[model samples]
Target: MSSVNTAIQLITREQAEQGATAKGSTCSPALAKGPWDYDLAEALAGIPAYGPGASSADVAPAATPRQGQLPEAYKLASDAELGERILAAKAALGDRAVILGHFYQRDEVIQYANFVGDSFQLANAALTRPDAEAIVFCGVHFMAETADILSAPEQAVILPNLAAGCSMADMADADSVAECWEQLEEIFGTEPDAEGRVPVLPVTYMNSSAALKAFCGEHGGIVCTSSNARTVLEWAFQRAQRVLFFPDQHLGRNTAKALGVPLEQMPMWNPRRDLGGNDAQALLDSRVILWHGFCSVHKRFNVGQIEKARKDFPGVQVIVHPECPMEVVDAADSAGSTDFIKKAIAAATEPTTFAIGTEINMVNRLAAEYPQHTIFCLDPVICPCSTMYRIHPGYLAWVLEELVAGRVVNRITVAESVQDHARTALERMLAARP
Candidate 1:
């Protein structure tokens, strides 16, 4: 199968000529156009929105960062021209720059990545290249913020597109979280129990903002990734009577469920309502307080898709990201992080059919990598993570060329006040063990 971008173009052309619906493809026709178009519109309209894709429906906060218009030259350049320009710029920058690509990034942008992995893995990879003056993260806003927090002071972390912000991360703002914290404090005081555990310990997923992570750091909390959520939760439980997990409810719920926490013990915290929409008794009895947030891309997957996959391909191994809803995770054969999903397929010896539930880009890449086996995404739609899709090849080329010209654009920097606390929480997570 061609790249999703190519498929979208073809489908769009066919649709215009034949007046036919995209047969098996479900992505919006808007995605058929270049992402730069949306970037320009967002800047002109003075409003921020996750451009066309899975997260298009998500409402971006008014404070959300916006990307400026791309130079017409870059936008007008053909794919081959952009590829050549990016390569030339990379050659000029040499060791001065290192590009990090998230698993969900489009193949066009990922092709130029010095290191490609999940957010945490990419951050660690940037550390390994300490000599590099710039870390170009082709992921979303939160991932770039993470790189800035973890990287050396002199090193600059750059995001290709400022508009490439995670909608899930935006769901839990610093102000909203702080408000929730104050309410929790009123109900469950700062005192520790007889076992010396605090009343509540804050734990923000890696998808959250630096301020939120710093909140965790200052309040005796820790940060967690999808891969290490279990370990982090166990770590939290040992120090506190109850834990507060945020930014991605599905991840928190799924992980806590796996640890045998009763459903009744985990209460969802809605920022809009008082007491997180729960009674005092329920809050007191809660072992894990879940925040109302989720990954829009993962939210698109459902049990129906899994059932369809099973019906179409018998004996297929179904794997989904833990970010998926509880029902979807429960229905799948296994739920793990992106790395876990990739490893599972690599470990398979027999020719197998695999149905994966995650961003379409990574699923498509996996399918291409292992042609011997049959691999397909559970969601037949070509929709990808909206923010990840924002990092188009045009943007990549523009950023690289700017670096070659000794100018830095779209650099992500964490405030000094936020860095220490955020780094503390991250360190606690690193020390946490199963």
Candidate 2:
């Protein structure tokens, strides 16, 4: 990864000379209540049924569902029945449909995945597959939206459950982003630029909304997943003097600081704050302004847990994701994305002991995959990414069976206009390659 940085620097330096451009948005000084940080109650809601304007809630936290029972259609069906349905769906859809699954998906669903990996990898996977016309994205809404942006114009992307959205992504919506931009412009001018030709680049994590992506697309911005944050940031630096990273402030702060940015230069933007997260002194002094947002799942891990892991197993390698709280990341040996974790382990030559600050299922699976090596999750708590957990095997079986039938249920489509802007942002990252 360090070796890749030199090449990134050179390409970005060349791009800086080319200039920054924001083409579509007439709201030159873009404007956003940034999004709420968390809403656990949203997870309790079952995935809302699809079509236009739908919501899923098992019950309001203030209340409860009508009964303990899920829908009768949701009763656990036999695995064999599911297999048959999947085969029929494949036969019926033939070359027109593809299934994209997240690594966190249950084995039952993973078994049927046309492709399985992290969110960005899944999006890249969806972009290929020339045989498929409709992509059955088996992940959450943010993921499906990413696929829609990456796929061919004719391709139809679908999310089985409309309510299957990512809370992390929800943390930063367009309205809030717009408001933030408006505030920034008020302080820093309509387009904070050195030459007046440069536009402030907006880079969103893949864990954001289709609308957000469109916002980026419309502006001179693009979307990045955890796996490609560094690449995306490298791209942003070329287009603008500063970056406004959304939702996961920790990831933004951690990544920028690691790239040699000083802590004092990294300011947190809290939408709930009076200044829209901008403290004039901090804003003037900083380079990366992280929007106040976080991942409740990763936040669950703590430094104490890492200390305990070290005590339990001496000489264990402690690896974590930047999404973790700063103190937790400070205590770990290293931090990176899910793919980075896998690659680091794979690159290790000898049998090693490892502790990971990430989802337990992935850690457990890695341990099993590398029986010769020892691996464990940092937190002993059994909590999971609850939203990702919503993708139960029951839903998987139903989706596959539905595919086997003659009907195509959930298809995701990012309008071409949105894609046009989104593509510019994505191309910038790809172009950042040395």
Best by lDDT: 1
Poorly placed runs, candidate 2 (over 4 Å): 1-74, 91-95, 191-199
What clash pairs does model 1 have?
none
- lDDT of candidates 1 onward, in order: 0.93, 0.67
- RMSD to truth, every model: 0.9, 14.5
Per-residue CA lDDT of model 2 for 224-309, tens digit only, reads: 76767887788778777777789788898878877888988888887778776556877767678888877766877898999998
| Model 2 lDDT at residue 355 | 94
lDDT of 1 at 111: 86
Residue 203 displacement (Å), model 2 = 1.7
Q: Model 1, which residues run further than 4 Å from truth?
A: none
Distance from true location, Cα of 4 in model 1, Å: 1.2
Residue-by-residue lDDT tens digits, candidate 1, 1-434:
79978877887777777776545564688988888889878878888999989999999999888998899999999999999999999999999999999999999999899999999999999999989999999999999999999999999999999999999999999999999999999999999999999999999999999999999999999999999999999999989999999989999999999999999999999999988899989999999999999999999999999999999898999999999999999999999999999999999998999999999999999999999899999998789888898899999999989999999999999999999999999999999965
